[model samples]
Target: MMEFTHTASFNGHCTTLPLSSNNVTLDPTVKDKWGRPALRTTFMNHPDDIATMKFFMERSMELMDAAGAIKKVGSYAENGQTGGVHLLGTCRMGNDPATSVVDRYNRSHDVPNLFMVDGGSMVTSGRGQPTMTIMALAFRAADHLIQAARRGEV
Candidate 1:
């Protein structure tokens, strides 16, 4: 029998305030083969992320020690994990237009019926994983949008 496990920690919550750091913009001078503007991504791992990974590494090593591991080999220090597989918070949802791209219900503040239900609507990343939360939000957004449409509120 074989068992596999990973020792990693992730926080979707960035230390930098929303609408302050990280962004995606189209390169005005560049275009795709289809004549569409190319996207320019700008992101850097925050210090808090490094700290969190280090903390998790320490805890993992302690667990290994308790498990009576004779040889421990891994480095979560110096070079911590960078970025994330679960991209989020691109179009943050908020009450203030200046700070967010979508409203609380995942509806675009600028477009009445425009709804953005995805990881992008998250204002902050949760700890480690966000797929479940993203799915739940999608359901909630759909329900709200359906109700709004029925009531002619959209």
Candidate 2:
């Protein structure tokens, strides 16, 4: 399946570069502000991704042929992989001692007791919309942070 990793720095710098190996090529040939070959994206799908695509095409063809399709044609994934599900980058937030810049209450990691106090600190949002989860994390973190302060964990 197509998968990618993303990282965001403490300074709010984030990037989402593709990591898949699928042949789903895209010629992003253009010049950038710095006079660089902007980018030419060509993803070669992972093995599982190709397999999944093949299965889908095969099944589709069989079904169509069974239904007496006269023009039964098929093609498989050349990149050889399943496919990537849309799992975004930087969807992580927590109070981990390291790696994460935000605490459970969404506070900056390096700063002492200073909080980002924003929605970007959330770590995961499961399946539902992230808005609701971020709000919930904020509420929970606020209460817990207050309690921690009372207990001297900060």
**C-alpha TM-score for every candidate:** 0.78, 0.36
lDDT of 1 by residue, 67-140 (tens): 77666765653353454466777788889998789987889998988998888887466554678888888888
**Which stretch of 10 consecutive residues in model 1 shows the poorest summed lDDT?**
8-17
Cα TM-score of candidate 1: 0.78
* lDDT tens per residue, model 2, 1-154: 4222322111111122334332223346677677776645444444554565566677777777666665555666454433433333232355575656666677667775775554455432333455566578778778878987999978
Q: Give me the runs in candidate 2 sitting further than 4 Å from their true place.
A: 1-91, 95-97, 148-154
